[model samples]
Target chain A: MTVSELAQLDDFEAVALPEADREIDGAYSGDLLSWVMGRARAGNAWITIMSNINVVAVASLADTACVILAEGVIPDEEFTATAQARQVNVLRSGKPAYEISLILGSVL
Target chain B: MSDALSFHYDVDGESFSSAGQASAGVKKNLRQLGIDPEIIRKVSIAMYEGEINMVIHAGGGEADITVEDNCIVIVLTDRGPGIADIDKAMEEGYSTARDNIRALGFGAGMGLPNMKRYTDEMNISSVVGEGTTITMKVFF
Candidate 1:
């Protein structure tokens, strides 16, 4: 499934749209940007509570399809803007990280 | 042979928000140069890990990237309190970053290992009070 398709699901809310629809091949749950950068797959949904601008950078470097901010963690405007500029998808979810991971795993 | 294309950047120590700017810029440059996408990703990730280290441990530093026909070389230099043990520092899950840094989604102690893992070659030189310089090469 693509990031846009996943975002349109009931649990996720799209905060920023990527320049294109990147396919979601997998999912990774981590708050450590460095760890995620080193471990996450190219087309994964990065599930995290990190709402900082650096999150966008890490996501871009890891080539993750989208960043899902779980537990309704809202990123600042600057972060979402950077996400848009970087062509990264950002999604907000009210579910916990584990639940989001499960939901993404079942679908992707 | 002709000299390789190069770019230099000075990373600001105070801004976590801007830590990966140099790497990001380098990635763009590599893309413009028509480097292979896989090689570009490796070089960018390795350089980015170095930049984060400079910000978290060295109070910032300078990054120099040289692109050659066969490989890309990155040199990162910083003058912060140096690593006492390179071996330990290279270990995963051995971070010395403060709790605040961890709160910012870093400090997982995977920086050096990740840098080495993504690159073809890695070297480190440091003194206790002086600073550290890391050289990494990623093959194109």
Candidate 2:
């Protein structure tokens, strides 16, 4: 699925749009940025509670299709702005990480 | 692209949120240079890991990325509490990052190992009280 489709899913909110359309081939749930950078494959939806700007960096580095801020973890204005500026797709969900993961699993 | 290109940035340690800016910038420049996506990923990931280390271990540092016809060299220099044991630090899962940093989702001891993993060559030079300088290269 494309990132736009993932954002348009039920209970999903698009916080920022990616600079370009990218294919979503998989998903990963991890808070450790470095580990995720090393492990997450290109085009995975990264599910995490991390809302910092560095999260955007990790997502970009790992080539994650999008960053889903789960469990109602809305990042600060600067962070979201940075995500948008970096052209990283960021989505927020009132649902927790596991639930979103399940939804992503089904959709993909 | 016959001539090598170099970019330098000062990493700010005050905010972990800002740690990877240098890496991100380098990635952008590399992409503009038309480097292979896989090679760019390797350099960006490795440099990003080193930037995180500079912030978490050393207060902040200087990051330099030089692109050559054959390879990209990354140099990180910081004046923080230098690593006491390179061997121990090199081991994955060995981290001395404070508890607070761990709370922020880092300090996994995977920094150096991951840097080494993504780069073709890595060298570390440190003085306990002085600082540490890591030089890494990714050959295209």
Candidate 3:
């Protein structure tokens, strides 16, 4: 499914959908930025509670389809601006990371 | 090599938020040079990890990237309190970073190992109180 389609889900809300049409090939759930950067596959929807500027950088470097901020974790204004500036897709989910991953698995 | 391209940046350590700016810049430069996506990914990840480490441990540093015909070389130098043991530092999950750093989604101790995993060659030289220099190369 495309990032835009994923954002349309009930549990997910689009925070920064700069690359809304990017396809979600898989899902990677992690909060550690370095581990996520190395293991998260390109086009994977990276699920995490990390709401920092570095999160935007990692999402951009990994080329993730979108960043799913689990547990309703909302990034600050700077993070949102950086995500938009970097053109990295970002979505917010009220569910936990595992639950978000399960939801992504069902759809993707 | 006369045909080689080189870029240099001073990593600012005062803010963790700006840690990966150098890596991001390098990624953009590589993309503009038409480097393969896969190679670009490897170089950027390795350099990004290095940049994060510099901020977390070395209090910032200098990153120099040299693009050759066959390989890309990255040299990171820092003058902070140096690593006492390179082997232990290379071990996954052995970081000395504070808890606050871990709260920021880093300090899992995977930086050096991940750097090695993504690069074709890596070398580290350090002194206890002096500084550390890490050189890594990724061959396209």
lDDT of 1 at A101: 79
Tens-digit per-residue lDDT, A1-108, candidate 1? 988898889999999986447888888999988789888988888999889888899888878889999998988889989999988899999999999978877887
How many residue pairs of model 3 clash at the backbone?
0
Rank candidates, DockQ, best first: 3, 1, 2
DockQ: which candidate is best?
3
User: Per-residue lDDT tens digits of candidate 1, residues B1-140?
Assistant: 28789999999999998999999999899999988877888888888889998998889999999988788999999998999999999999999999998888889999999999999999999998999999999876
- State the weakest 10-residue window (summed lDDT) of model 3 chain B: B13-22
- Cα lDDT, model 3, residue A97: 93
lDDT, candidate 3, at B128: 84
lDDT of 1 at B33: 91
Clash pairs, model 2 backbone: none
Winning candidate number (lDDT): 3
Report residue B119 deviation for candidate 2 (angstroms): 0.9
lDDT value for model 1 = 0.90
